[model samples]
Target: MSTVQLYAWGPALGAPSIDPKCVIIEAYLRLLNIEYTVVQTNDPQASPTGELPLIKDGNVWVAGVDRILTHFSMRNQDANASLTPEQRAVYLAYNAMIQENLYDCMLYTWYADMTNFVKSIRPTYAKLLSFPGRYLVPVQLKNSAKARLAKYNVEITSDDTTLPQNEKEEMKELQRTGWHHMYKLARETYASLDAQLGSQKYMFGDSPTTLDCIVFGYLALHLYPDLPHGRLRHILTHEYPRLAEFCERFNAAYFSREHDVSTPAEDVPSLWKVLVNNPRGFFSNVKDDIVSYMGTDAPKEKSTAQIDFERKRIWSIAGGVTCLLAYIIWNGIISVEFDGEQGDFESWDEYDQEEVDEEL
Candidate 1:
């Protein structure tokens, strides 16, 4: 009976759907009775691996939600072990593809409501949110965010959920007029999916599989029930009942863990949009990205050219898996040295030995 350390995340942005991998992880761990700790992950900026959720199993470090969940199933004892050998491999491959595809569509569209997002989902966020509006979620973001948040709160939550007449009408107009392009992209994708789910139980079947796990989380956290804040107001729980039901069922089954936000604040997950596809391949959040969010001009030079090398390397490794087999074969993950300078940990555990690693 060994245990592993799972560094998880529940973000404050109140992205109700949040992380699919985490949802998968939660269901697997509980079903398998795998003794593990459910904790928030570090801000990617401060983590050894820039993304989460990360799982530490002895000397091995696995990142990304899908990667970590497979790590759990592979090495840990599976009480029921429903996945066949072939099935497991296929699930891994498909999960990666779908997750990336969804994100590509999502990130591009998320910024459209970059400002209006505050006014849309105020009720769900009104609780468990920390950080004041003044310094919260960056600056240029504050004013719009506050107005939107306040408006959203007023709409969804009234003494009896009776949003004011003017308030309702105003929100409706904003949806049709303001930031509509972004809204269309973000909402239409789900509208199609929602349409497709007319009678099915899951995406492909009655029984849930890996794909179901991903879809459930993605839709719940991002789609379903509502649009991103204020931009896509046309789509709401009242707008799409079946899809909304799907989201509710998925969350009830998967994200059932107590997301008690206060303790060990570091465990919560926060996603930052980075300009990773830069020409020179320098990765940075760029001061401008947060300047509006933070209401301050970015430092004269806040580029992460130096610190971003590792991030670039990791991303390059991931991107090359498709066509650059040779690059992967020769430019492997191990170390190479011209002159012998002490470098490269023999294993992932040496740098950060987890107390949980001992149990596992």
Candidate 2:
């Protein structure tokens, strides 16, 4: 059988991938002792679902961590095979809690929190992209994060002086209320995880399972990155030291090798190589990225103001490009040059005189 190919976001800050989902998938593969070559890419479009941590084995392609696990299950490689039905039920409950509550907290800290977004998140993603993507992707990710949190009534807001005094007060109150709720959720979730872990090495007995991988994935991101506003990290480290210790041990066991197993250097594609091999695909991905960045992936019922704003933004970009091209042409930076020899000509008076003398 051919070695499986794992496509994920590039690693950063001691994590296999900046994305927690990617980290979970990588850890699961390592835990299973699967022979897979990691293919690092910044483009989420590589996956059919337009997400990361995809796996390609022979003719089969799996886009998500859950679906990949299901794919593995068909081959009798289930990670939670040893778990009792009761334990599996527990795992599902905790998993949903983590995904619903803790994941939102992570998103808020990394993207919605302006301090962390500007200081850590944006810079991290910026390094992974090329050209305009460096400027665009971070903002898109931030907007997506905010949109995801909107349903939870969580938001990050800055004081808008343009608004009326009462409106400004309302916004400020909403910001405080939202973050307070988020912090509370994070604290409660950590406490529950810590209580469940107790002194056990793994979540369930000696062997690590899918739940362990998921827990570690979230914990590692919180513990590893040195974010400016690090509220989630603060809660985990100070309030839930057991969870913190679990993350440390987990990291040492799976990720502390001299040669990193998750991202093999040779298997990773270079930007130039991707462009050369599939230029059309590469630009198509870029266009998709730009459209996504513009928040086209948000809910279909956009406000009229938002629609107008997007239209103006597109027109502005087009106008800017047009102006740039016109400037280049007008300044002779891009001009037509003739190679034909030049013919010398006399003034009209001299030509007339010469003609008269010839006639005489």
lDDT (CA) for every model shown? 0.44, 0.69
Clashing pairs in 2: none
Alpha-carbon shift of residue 145 in model 2 (angstroms) = 1.0
What TM-score goes with each of the models? 0.49, 0.70
Q: After superposition, how far is residue 92 of candidate 2 from its true place, in Å?
A: 1.2
Cα lDDT for residue 290, candidate 2: 49
In model 1, where is the ten-residue run with the lowest total lDDT? 273-282
lDDT of 2 by residue, 1-360 (tens): 778888888888667678888888888888898878787777765554557777877777777777888898788888999999999999999988987877788887775565566557767887887644565556556666767889877764321112223645544644663767778888899989888888899999778899999999887788778886677778888888899989988888887752233553353333433333444454455565446535433246445644554565455545544664466457643344455775432222321211110000
Candidate 2, residue 270: the lDDT equals: 38
Q: Taking the tens digit of each residue's C-alpha lDDT, what string does model 1 give over 1-360?
A: 445566654544344324445655655555455666655532332234455566555556666665665665576544225666875675565566546544433332232232233333332332323322112222222233333434223121110112224756645644543334434555665666565466777554465555566665565445543443432324535566676677677667655665333232344222211211121121122233333333343333223541242244334434433333343235542244444765542232322322211000
* Clashes, model 2: 0
